[model samples]
Target: MSYRELIFTVPAEIAEPLGDALLELGALSVTVEDAAAGGYDENPLYGEPGLSPEVQAWDRSAVTALFNPEIDHSGEANFIPELLASLKESDFHLAQPSEKIVEEQDWVRLTQSQFAPIQIGKRIWVVPSWHEKPTDPNAICLAVDPGLAFGTGSHPTTHLCLLWLEQNGDLENKSLLDYGCGSGILAIAAAKLGCNPVVGTDIDPQAMVAARSNAEINHTLIQFILPNEDAPELAADTKYDIVMANILANPLQVLAPALVNKMRVGGRIVLSGVLARQADEVIATYSQWLKLSVWQESEGWVCLHGELLSAISNEQSNPSHIESIATPQKKRLKLVLLSLFFLVLLVFAEHLSRNSLLPTLATRIDGTSSPIAVSAFSLLQKTDEILCRSLRCINRSVSDFTAWKINSASLAQESSGEPLKIPANQSKLQVEIQNRLAIPVLFPYLELTLTDAEESEIKTIQFSPQEWLPISWQDSHPLFLLRGAPSGESIHSELAFVMPQNTAGYRVRIFYSH
Candidate 1:
């Protein structure tokens, strides 16, 4: 069977009334859209959370009404004339409607065909229920269909967040909280990827309904609740290994403390739905509790990632511990200043001696050097020498052995120091690794593999950060190496070790500890 689609160009005041009139005049359905759509002055309505536009219809509206021509009540050969007469009788002075014959088809198949399987990251494949089979059967298929709620895995913000979750392969049995979870897609994905005891919370009660339904359809054990619900997992004391909030920048900044409180110490946080321009402000807002950096950006949107290295709270947040460390740092500063003062005084004292005589000589009679005068002169010279020696020693001892900053003359030397002097039993290996990722991570282990001419591994040695990093650096900035390398930066290390015989080739590799 075929149906007739009538399109009428009507003004804002008449659009809604015309649609209602058409429905009463044997029209099967009616949908109104903007007449100037796809043109220069095209207008679109956007209703953000808790807000909506004043009028639902556009200034110039295109009202489309579907009618079954065969079931016309007037028994006329043509239904257009009869429908127009009825609308005119009802005081809807609409223009002559344009007509189109639409052939009936299986709408379910047609609608489902438009949404193919989307592969996200490595392990996730968002498959609709009607898809029947996925392109990659081994992929962790998410049985999600387009719904009224957000997060269908098609938008860039949702895609980037899903990509992060999919690529993270170490989520086994980790607790997760999907804050501001819409449709519970993230919570469901995390649960499928081995995140146990997952909880999803949103302020909207309808979101909880959609989240629960989606979780049930995916066969994942998840707890979906409103933010104020009496759930143990969402209590004030509860903390999660991973806290994901794919919310906007403004809300994220406002809820920074609340979200940080949800994370356990050393736990990771994933954020999304932030514009590229707004990324910096959001990062700075969260930096107080933890360091947040842009993990990835897509279509002018960015996903931020960070780890909560320390516990953060509103009341205390360990201020006493911070002051304790600050006290020692202040003492060190005072010691440095005192050392500089002593060095300056030593220089002044040496100037007074003038390389010939001390103040004691000026007090001597007949310009002759006495025993007491000589003793005082020697004591002043000795004190100056001691201060010079002690300060220089301190400076040299505290200097960076491998600071790797500033261009160096030694950097010109190749890895193999002088090909002629390449040691047979012992060799020096230099390794430099650059972090290509956007976010910083903990320092990785450097692995050196020794191979013979046949490419078989003759021997290998794994160097932990402690082995390759300078001892002074590790002692001074212990948390830096523990946190990770700076984003898109390089680290250099040189090692001298005993080499096994028949070592003709070598390979260098770097990776995080675990």
Candidate 2:
């Protein structure tokens, strides 16, 4: 259930305090604009119906603030009741205005437990968390969960193409792409089918994260990119051997030109996400851009496959094709060498003139240069190997260290049907903090707990923090060593054993930094 705005015409003096109290009560965001000062746009995209049949001067003077108490249709009727009580307690006098702004209750559930995995083809499965992984060896596995936006791979359009891929031409050595990739399933499937350098693009960052995580889980080397519809840089100007899009009809129309441009001259394209009724419209949109070939239709979904046709005129008299002539000019090799020598001499003379004959005195910064130089010189090709091994270790340590006070960590564990708990007030300061242990950990089986000085349990530990780091433990357990630079973009974690809670302050762990 979303929130509603409570429009009250109160005196200007009490508006600020009233808004604050309402916020404290549970409003998500509040805005107080001068209604009396007219000419301001009220929601540029959507225009709300007027509050009353006839506008009152009070409605213009009073601040209309929106509150999201997380109420539903059944709960909205109680708003005036609570407002009346709050008014009486605040000792404010008010009257009902001429108009009422009533919004239909729309129940949106952010919790995604009801969504299940989707079966694309006979052997391809897109298993979201709500369903179990398919046991069939032939099933191509895809682990993901959709939030807010679309793409679970169960849609008719996605299934239609998956079926086609399962029955179609060889995917080996083919460069593939998933344009408007919602969850990157198609792109991942291509990589799993032996396509090299599979690429996926979406408009959402959250979707990109989900896609990357899914790719990692599936062990597919697909690169997912979040590209703006208007920007070309985000969608690197490169061609692919095979491209597929499961996006809708309208965007598909606009995407045809861009997508066709991305395909190699004779490369294939698979376009889904169109209704059966809209298939002809989609076909017509792409026909002008590419030479439309065979199409596959299943369960009212259409997947168009085609080779790109040259837009250039195919008629004769255009010289059929243009050719390049590389004619070398005759020259004296000795004369060219002499010219190069003179140029080098001129450059060296200029360099000598730019620098002083004597060495200038300089201040030397400590430590920064060597470490920075070493890190910069390290081969980037091995960064992933380092990250995966180190992150796995950090995750293990965090799991072995503590479990309480961490609410909603990104490290997803298998459903044990038991809530993770940590002892509270345990003198164990470091290991007792739960949230501190969560962001650094990334495995599914590890657990953390808190114990006392005498190894007794106390209150359940609770913890929360905006950021954390995973510091890699060296070969030994007691000593910890840092591998990479302290990165704000990536999280780092460390482990600690704690005593059962007693509200004891925490001491920092000392570690060597590279």
Candidate 3:
């Protein structure tokens, strides 16, 4: 319902008591803000790691109290006089009060009205669940909803980060790490844009839960984890192609070392959730490990992008030295080294492809002439055909083959199983696979071992997406990708595998590589 709002500018010492007195005088709710906000006299209060909580309130307070309009027919004319007289008798003086009518609103609709499809760059859009997907066929729309976490793409900080992501171009086949991943927006966007193996870490379990839920909604695969004291040790073991952190300045400054250590040399780091005035302090904090500069600014928020500097020394150095090392010659040298590294990987993959060890072993298996073995071989051949067609290339000739492999480990390692529907008369068992991994797997072949009631091995057969596609009637895009298992982001294609009717149970083992 509509209400009246009474506002008073009071000294910090009197603000709390005045608010309490208003509540006792029938105010529904009372809140305080800095009277000088957004002005030359503004005072911004920030809480640091070791600071006491008592210092949180503003120095000069604008106390606002909400009251039912019917309580005082004359508005402030009656209530303000009564309130001032009571305070004075108590030896507490309050300045002149102001009143305004607050119109009643449909709060739910009002909140929803404040959010709409937010476009980032030319290719990406953040869409709320209630809205229709963007009509732009090329637009990468992320279905996000407001949740308990921090991000909704409405905040200026989030906007800045998303803009950076869009301007950076295709993240396809790259690994990304999202630190302080509230709502998992950035990580999900990266996954949609083709970044393989996106990892999102947050200190709040609620945020982690929200992030995972958002990823699932977007049909993107992202690994969300809670980072604790031992996070540094785990972070040191892995390196990312890009690292993004959209958190406040203090935490960002404190995390500089850890974030830098987790990035590959020359890899890019994107940071946001910082005010324009606080940019210099954050830049100075990270300058030790990365050469940082303001990349973009929007609505008073700034995004900083930087490249990890060479790891030539353990001690901290000046920003000038970091800048010096990021010169064109050094960048070229780094690029050359990276190219050679990938070249070695390609050669290694080629060797594996040429060996054809798995096929040879399958062909030589005992009882290959038997019907079960023959059927298994047929399934394997069919899977190979589907992979070649859908993945575009089965051999190392495809550059993405190596990238797929590198990005595979980034997918969620957890596996879940469920029974697939089948005819009651058929002596075959069908199982469905939920490939939670971030990168697509090529020709995911599963080996199933049939067992009798006595739990003794009876017969074995293999099944893959090709065999499951016709039986399961699933979409062909994800299963038949010539590139391998398509990235299981929004829709994880369930590949059905058929097994010889099991009198008892069976064991499953999946085999595939990028």
Error of 2 at 339 (Å): 71
Candidate 3 ranges with C-alpha deviation above 4 Å: 37-42, 46-59, 69-78, 85-91, 229-235, 275-280, 309-514
Error of 1 at 274 (Å): 3.9
Deviation in Å, model 3, residue 332 alpha carbon: 26
lDDT tens per residue, model 2, 1-514: 3445555434345667666765655655455544334332121111223212232222223445555444423246666556656655776444321122445443244345456667765767778755678788888877766654456666777777777777665888888888878777778777877788788888888778878887897887877876654444235467888888887777878777788878876788888877677777778888766755437777776777887755423444455333211111223566688889986774444334322211121111222224543453232213323544544422212222221222112111123212112223112121212222212222222233322322233433332221133323222322322222111112234333333323211112122112
Which candidate leads the pack in lDDT?
A: 1
| lDDT scores in order | 0.72, 0.52, 0.67
- Per-prediction TM-score to the true structure, in the order listed: 0.54, 0.41, 0.54
Backbone collisions counted per model: 2, 25, 14
TM-score of 3: 0.54
Cand. 1 Cα-lDDT: 0.72
Whichever of 2 and 3 has more lDDT, that candidate is 3
Query: Model 1, range 1-514, lDDT digits (tens) per residue?
Result: 8887777756566778888888877789999997658854355764544335666777567798887757864334556666767776898654345556788899989988888888898779888887865556568888878776788888898899899998888999999999999888899999999999899999878888888998999999998888777888888899999999998877888889889999999899999988898898899998878899999999999999999987664444666678867887999999999999997876676655433333223222222235665566557657656756655421111111121211101111134453212135455665565543323445656677766644478888898878887676677676765455554456566677777655544545555555
Each candidate: RMSD: 28.2, 25.8, 28.8
Runs of candidate 2 exceeding 4 Å displacement: 1-113, 129-131, 228-237, 293-301, 309-317, 321-514
Candidate 1 minimal-lDDT segment of 10 residues:
403-412
